[model samples]
Target chain A: AQSVTQPDIHITVSEGASLELRCNYSYGATPYLFWYVQSPGQGLQLLLKYFSGDTLVQGIKGFEAEFKRSQSSFNLRKPSVHWSDAAEYFCAVAANSGYALNFGKGTSLLVTP
Target chain B: DVKVTQSSRYLVKRTREKVFLECVQDMDHENMFWYRQDPGLGLRLIYFSYDVKMKEKGDIPEGYSVSREKKERFSLILESASTNQTSMYLCASRRQGTTNEKLFFGSGTQLSVL
Candidate 1:
């Protein structure tokens, strides 16, 4: 079974600062990784996903994640944070068949001015 | 833009009541999924339908069931609502054969069982 682990439960960053959220997964084969963001009272939206080729994948709202197979880690990062970037972030992993997405507990991001 | 819409944004149901949560996708996707979101447990998949009238149990499917009579609509039913079932329920749809493709999600239905 594929499982995802997000180390950070909550993170606080000031506007214009760089941010990184850690994610690690346990899968047998090459896994499909995804990042999702959920604002208050909203559903999860895809940020970006890594399927095969690219080690680094870019997502919406200037967010990106790198897939490191050796370390079993796919961490989400943003060069600069904005006030509107405050939301809950989840890292999910699916098998090769994409049966169902296994999600992390999610990291709640708090952007402060 | 493609979208998934849930019938209710918030619902209040009493214990032992049968609760129905409806989800419809405009993109005509073949796969629809229902998930419940709790504070620390994350999103746990309850059920999914790969095609019309075909359903499958997800990781957590004990108390919930699903119906997909039409191509674009999927509904989740709670046989007997319990306080533990009171949480945010999310509906998602994805295109067929594209497992890596992004899933479109509805705003979600927040159900409260008292």
Candidate 2:
């Protein structure tokens, strides 16, 4: 079974500040990694996903995540964040042939001006 | 754009009452899923359907059932609604035959069981 772990339950970053949200997964073999964001009163939206090949994957809203196979980590990072980037982020992991995704507890991002 | 439409945005039901949550997808997706979201829990899968009349129990399937008589529509049923079942229900769909699994989600239906 693949599981995702997000160490930070809540994170606060100032506007124009660099942001990094850490994510770790537990799987014996290579797993599929994904990052999703959910705004207030909105549904979950896909940010980026890493299946294979490139270790660094780019997503919408200037977000990117790097997949480190050796460390079993897929951390999301942004050079600069905006106030509108305040939302809850989730990290999910699924097996290569799995049908369901196991999501983390989520990290609530608060962007302070 | 892929669209997954859940019938209700919000619903209030009484304990022991029978409840149904409907979901439909516009894109002819082969897989559809039902999930419940809580404060700490990001999302817990309840049920999923791979094809019409084919269903699979997800991580948390107790106290809930699902019906998929058609390919585009998947229905979640709670035989006896309970307060613990009160949460945001989300429906998602994704095309099969690929490992991408980029799910298209509905707006979600907030069900409050009293």
Candidate 3:
């Protein structure tokens, strides 16, 4: 079974500061990776996805993630974060053939002024 | 934009009551999923339907059943509601035949079983 691990349970950053959320996966082969964000009382929204091609993928809301095969990691990063960026972030992994996604426990991002 | 609409934004039910949560998709997607979200637990899949009349069990299926009589609608049922079942329920849909497609989600229904 493919699984995703997000080490940080909570992260806080000041407005305009750079942000990075760590994600690691355990899969036998190269897996499909995704980053999702959820605001309070809202459903999950896709931040970005990585299937094939370049390791780095850009997503909506000025967010990006890099798939590092050697580290079994697909970490989400942003050059600068705004207050709206404060939300719960999840990392998910799926097998090449499976349709279901395995999600992490999530990391709560807090932005301060 | 794809929209997956869940019938209710909030629901309250008593123990042993029958509960049904309805989900409908507007994009004519072939795949629909039901998941439950709790604090510190992320989202756990409860059930998924790949096609009309075709359903699959996800990570957690206990005390839950689903119906997919029509392609655009999928319903989740709780035969006997329990306090443990209280959580935020989310419905999502995505097109089949693609490995990289992202899921479109509903705003979610927060269910409280007392």
Misplaced by over 4 Å in model 2 are none
The sequence of per-residue lDDT tens digits that candidate 1 reaches over residues B13-108 is 999999999999999899999999999778988998888999999899998888899999999999999999999999999988888998888989
Report how far off residue B59 is in candidate 3 (Å).
Answer: 0.6
Query: Model 3 Cα displacement at B109 (Å)?
Result: 0.7
How big an interface RMSD has model 3?
1.4
- What overall lDDT, based on C-alpha atoms, would model 1 receive against the true structure? 0.92
Best by DockQ: 1
Kindly give the stretch of ten consecutive residues in candidate 3 chain A with the minimal lDDT sum: A94-103
DockQ, cand. 3: 0.69
Better of 1 and 3 by DockQ: 1
- Error of model 3, residue A22, in angstroms: 0.8
| TM values, all candidates | 0.97, 0.97, 0.97
Q: Could you give the TM-score of chain B for each candidate, in order?
A: 0.98, 0.97, 0.98
Structure candidate 3, residue pairs in collision: none
How big is the positional error of residue B102 in model 1, measured in Å on the Cα after superposition?
0.6
